[model samples]
Target: MASPALPGREPGAGPRVEDLVQEVKRLRAEVEQLRVESAQLQRAVASHAVVDQAIGVLVMTAKINPEDGFMVLREISQHTNTKLSLIAEQIIKHAQDAALPETILAELHAALARRR
Candidate 1:
């Protein structure tokens, strides 16, 4: 038996129901992609903030210039096999406690001394 047409929709007028369903599916996929992109952007922004703060800490605590401070972070990130943002986050957290690990403290001092 044929299904009755919806009210205000003729049997063969406008888009078929399947077409509308496909369009809704396509829109949902697009929305999901946008959500994932938004999350990535948010993380990038947050990581940038942490890295900036860490650079400031290096400048003040290590007495290194901003350029050298960034270099120090990059060097540590490379040496430690860690992401730059993760290294920056660790530095900021340790700085907050005023108790950085001995090895990291030594490295920061060495980097600063080298810059002199």
Candidate 2:
């Protein structure tokens, strides 16, 4: 396959070792960027999981809409002086374990919702 570089020339066609080193550095930068993006995606997924579970709990216990449930979580996080993502992770893990007690869920929801 032809690369965007010169047709006959290799990607790093230069004879100097510095060129090869530069290519390696460039590739390393790309790899690092990909790693950072992957980590961000993981955090996003975790946040979504927490929000989804909290919403479900709210809908079941408080008969609230999804928007209201999210707003409540945002509020609680703000009031508790904690990160929203952290709060979400706690809620998600508890819900996933299937051992979350009703009292705890209610308290957590209330705590998270008060921030906003």
Candidate 3:
């Protein structure tokens, strides 16, 4: 007797079991990749927000334009061997208290004073 066809497949025409397993593996890998990509995107957005807040503080406190504000933040980040986002996060945290740490304030002033 002829074997019955698998559900939704013609007799002898559907993917083999191994092929289905491989397809499931491929789909799982894709889902994992998407998860990693999503996490990276979320971190990037959070970092961008901190950086923007730092820029705003620079603009308000240093009387600098937004472009120069970002430049100053970048320069300070470079000088301190810190990530720009970290520097920005620190700035935002301190600014909420209406003061920055003395060293950071000094570095910020110097960075702003320098020509890019």
The candidates, ranked best first by TM-score, are 3, 1, 2
Error of 2 at 50 (Å): 1.4
lDDT of 2 at 50: 70
**Residue 9: error of model 1 in Å?**
5.9
Question: TM-score of model 2 relative to the true fold?
Answer: 0.63
- Shift of residue 91 alpha carbon in model 3, Å: 1.0
The TM-score measured for candidate 3 stands at 0.85
Candidate 2 lDDT, 1-116, residue by residue in tens: 74455667778574667887999999999999999999999988877887788777766666777787777667657766667666556656665575544644565656545534
* Global local distance difference test of model 2: 0.69
Spell out the clash pairs found in candidate 3.
none
lDDT of each: 0.84, 0.69, 0.87
| Candidates 1 and 3 compared by TM-score, better number | 3
TM-score of each: 0.79, 0.63, 0.85
Instruction: Identify the leading candidate in terms of TM-score.
Output: 3
Best candidate per lDDT, number?
3
Over 4 Å off in model 3, which ranges? 1-10, 98-103
lDDT tens digits, residues 1-116, model 3?
99899888889896788999999999999999999999999999999998999999888977889999999899888888889998898888878775766777788879877834
